[model samples]
Structures are given as C-alpha cells and as structure tokens.
Target: MIEAAFRVLKVLEESDTPISGEEISKQLDISRSAVWKHVQELRSYGYEIASSRAEGYDLIASPDRLLPYEIEKHLKTWHIGRYFDYHDSVPSTIGVAKELCRNKNPSELHGMVVIAEEQSGGVGRLGRAWYSPRGGIWTTIILRPAIPVDHVFMVTMAASIAVARTIRKFCGAGALIKWPNDIYIGNEKIAGVLQEISAEAETVNYCLLSIGIDANISEEQLPSGVKTPITTLFRACGAPVDRARFLAQLLREFETRYREIESGEYHTIAREWKSLSLTLDKRVKITTPRKSFEGEAIDIDEYGALIVRKDNGKVERVFSGDCTPA
Candidate 1:
C-alpha cells in the first residue's frame, strides 16, 4: 500500500498540473478509490494534497520529517544509507539496528541506516541520556567492515569528519570535531557519534555507528540543566536547515571516508581529523569508567586514541572516554 502511495506521489511530483485520480489509477493499475486512499496516506505523512472536482489532485507542500522517501530524493551515496529505514519515534535507532543485525545477514545489512525523528530512550557515552527530540537527526548505520579490530575507532573518526564537513558545506556552519567523537560549533556541542562493535579475536564482525545531530531544533526544545552547552543548527544559523539534504551529504562524506580506511589510508583520516580538531592544544578533562583527569589534549594517534599530557608531566593515551574542555 505504501509502495502504491510512493508511486502515486511520483506521478504527482512529475506532473506540472494536477493529476486526475482516474489517470493515476490507469497508470498504476489500481482502482480510483485506491488512488484516493493512497493519496490520503501521503497526506498523513505530512504531504499537502489539494483535491478539486474539476482539477483532480495537486501536491502543495512536503513536511520536514526525515522520511525515507524524502531522504532518497537527495541521497547520492553508493552504499551508506542506500538501504534506509525511518521511524516517527523509537526507543533508539541503536536498538533497532541491533535487532536488524540479529535477523539479517551482517553483510547484507552493511551500510543500512536506521533513522528516527525522535528517541524516547536515546543514550550517549557512559550511558548518559541523549536528548533526542523532534527536529533532530537521530540515526544508526550498521556496518560489516573489513578492517581490523584495533582500528575500529576509525569509524567514529570518519563519522565525525563527515558530520563536520556536511554542516560546513551544506548548512554554512563553522563546525569542528572535539576529541574522541563530538562535533562542536564554538564552545557548544551540535552532534555526537557513538560506536558499538562486535568482534572476535582480531576481526570486527560488525559495527553500529549511532549519530545524533541537532539540526532544526530550537532553544525552547532544548532541555534544561544539561552539563554542557548544546546548540542546534537552527539556532546557530538563525534558521532551520534542510535535514534530508544535510543527512544525504553526511552519508556521502562518511562513505568516502569509510572507503579510505578500508583501503588502509589511516593517515588521510588522521590528517583530516587533525586539521578540524578543536580539542588539540586545549585544557581538557578525560573521564573513563575507572578514572578522570585534567590535562592538555595534545594529539590523536594513528589508532584514534587521544594523547594528552597530564599536569604532573606524564603523557596518557586514552582509548575510550568522555572528553570535555576543562
């Protein structure tokens, strides 16, 4: 039924004038009543359809939701986001991606992106609550990568670079990467990347990269009492951004960087990440499951670990942790 609706929408989109239900029925080989039903379905998904006795139906507008159909319109990636799933609301895209991995072959599910308009139970590093409201891009990409287990952090690095590039090129925002995996504009965070990996011995079985971006959210939409300052593209740019276009560009950038790592171009990833670094040469606080310390964030090693010089004149390499500016 949704497929028929998509076909109906296609016909309507291609036509300059209104298309009659009878013409649509004949083109799609469905009944006129079915055409009307499909048109209603499109309307429910935030499409504005105008119906007239003499003029038939006309498409007036489309909503800002990250519907799969909408994303596919602007998508140009070869693999990443090629297979897309969208939800109006979910507990988390991560959970959905995990479920899909269990049910389907990991190879077949590679580069599949599961997106949600909102998340009720979204989480970030260290099991912190991620404020996933509407007007944000909350998604998880399932990957069956061919890279070694120790280099999995490159996935997060590639993602952060993709996000920063997309925001800069598409939205005209000055975005930069914070150490580990966060995108920042000025002192506030605008996006974050979290990775969950499955591996055995030295081979990575699969990886789930969950990315959340505050695209079109407003100040009122932001929750109170958050430890770090969080800003949205809308607030930053003084207007709302096109979420579909931004996401499409981001996926393309990510696929490009992911391909680099697959070909053993770790230095390319490291170079790009360093050029866009906001954490380097800054005082920072690194918190792990066991300990927390303040130091000067020096550089990122080849494996994506952060190298920091502690106040006591000792250098520490952090593999996975929460990094914030001190």
Candidate 2:
C-alpha cells in the first residue's frame, strides 16, 4: 500500500500542474476515497502533500531519506534496480544480499539492489575491513545469471568497468581500471568491486556484486595504518557530484555490460576493458598464494583473466590474485 501511495506521489511530481484525486483514481483504478486514504498514508511517510479546494493534491517535498521512491526516481536501468531494499544503516549490504538469497526466491529477485547509507561492519575483498563512512556509496546488487561457474569472474570485471566508467564520465577521462577490480584516478584508488557468489557443484545460484565508491568521504574518516592510497570524487573533482545521478549511470552501464556477457559478447567488453585498462602493457608484480611473479601485463583473456608475460620469456594467466604494477 505504501508503494502504491508512492507511485501516486511520483505521478504528481512529474506533472507541471496539480493532479486531482478523481484523475488519480481513474488512472490507478482506485476509488476517490481510497486515493484520499493513500494521500493520508503518504503524509505519514514524511511526504508533504498540499490539499486545497482548487488543486486536489501536490507533492511539496519528500524526506531526504534513501527510500525506494527516491532511488527509483533516479534509476534508469530496466532490471538492475527493479527491486530495491534501502536502509538508513546496516551491518553490510552484501550480508543482507546473501541472507536474502537464502530466504527468498533468487529467480524472482533479479537486479535487487541493497543500499545502506551507513555500514557498521562492512567487509571488503579477502576478509579485509571496508570503512563505509556515511558519504560514500556502499551498496550491493543481486543477480541471477545463467552462465558457467568458471565465467563468474566476469561479473567482477563488469563491475570494475562500471565504476571506472562512471568516475571517468563524471570526474574526467583520466580514470582507469587497475588490475583485479580497483578503480584508479592517476595513482589514488577511487573505488573497488567485490564479487561474491553462491553456487552448487557446477552452477551458480546467485551473485552478490558489491561496489564501494568513495564519493564524498573525507580522508579523516579512514582507519589508521591502512592507507595504501585513497581518493574520492569530491577530492578528485573539487566538488561533490550527485550520488543519485552517478549511481543511476553506473547501474545503467553495468546492466548494458552484464547483458552483453549474458549474450556471449565477452569480446566486446573485453575490448573496452582492455582499452580502459591501467595494467595492460605495464610492468607489474602479481602475488598469489603459491608464488609471486614480476612481469608486464599484456592482455586479459576472454574469461577476464589477466595474462602477464614475465621477464623470463614465460607467459602466465592469472585467475585471481593481487596485482601491483612495477
């Protein structure tokens, strides 16, 4: 019922003039009295609706909260954010997404986005602690793709591409994709992607693609002794870009790339990913559990694995590891 009320409010918001209750009732197929009841309900949700004799109703202001109405207002993708679960504060968006996948129907919940304004216990890649301050964009996207388990890593590549493209589009064209899911602006890290999946023997059930972008977070908010190098959109661009707009564009781009992957168009994204890659043709050091090698990143394979040609005339394809350019 609250969602229905919000839908009505959104219609009123798009209109240049006021909307009458009768018109709303006719459009929604609800009675005038029901529309009045929904209006009252909307008011309780912190929506200021102007009710007068001349104009039936008008939306004055919506609460500055991360509600589905606000998120959907800026969202542009068809499936990426069709369902949203927003929280003022949560332990972790990825945690919530994982729990949702277990309890709910995964097939019915495609593109469900979990967003938190503040995360109390955010987790990063490889069990690292992620500092999710209030101003940053901390969110996770739930996806159910029918792809082979081996190709699941492509989702992380898609996310990295999305974040890098978003930063470049908003800030400038200098943004680049660091190896293994990090976005870099010059030398400082601006964002990162962490892809978690639930799978069976040889098939993936669902994937929780979490992305953390330092939009307006300050340096003081970061923890001590953990600084590799970090930069925010505010610091890079001299001003804070609109988070909603950036998220919208990011989701749209991600959806496009994700669909391409589903359609076996990995070569297309691979081409773009290579062009935008910061690791390609650069001397780098890759560290894995078994061994570490210093080499030059030559290309990324169709499976999104990094291919590095070492100094010893040996070529290696890395599936997952930490990469640092030498």
lDDT of 2 by residue, 190-259 (tens): 8889998889988889999999988877778866676568888988878877777788889998999999
| Candidate 2 segments exceeding 4 Å error | 1-65
Candidate 1 Cα errors over 4 Å, as ranges: none
Winning model by TM-score: 1
Candidate 1 residue-wise lDDT at 225 = 92
- Model 2: how far is 35 from its true place, Å? 10
Model 2 lDDT at residue 194: 93
Q: Return the clash pairs for model 2, or none.
A: none
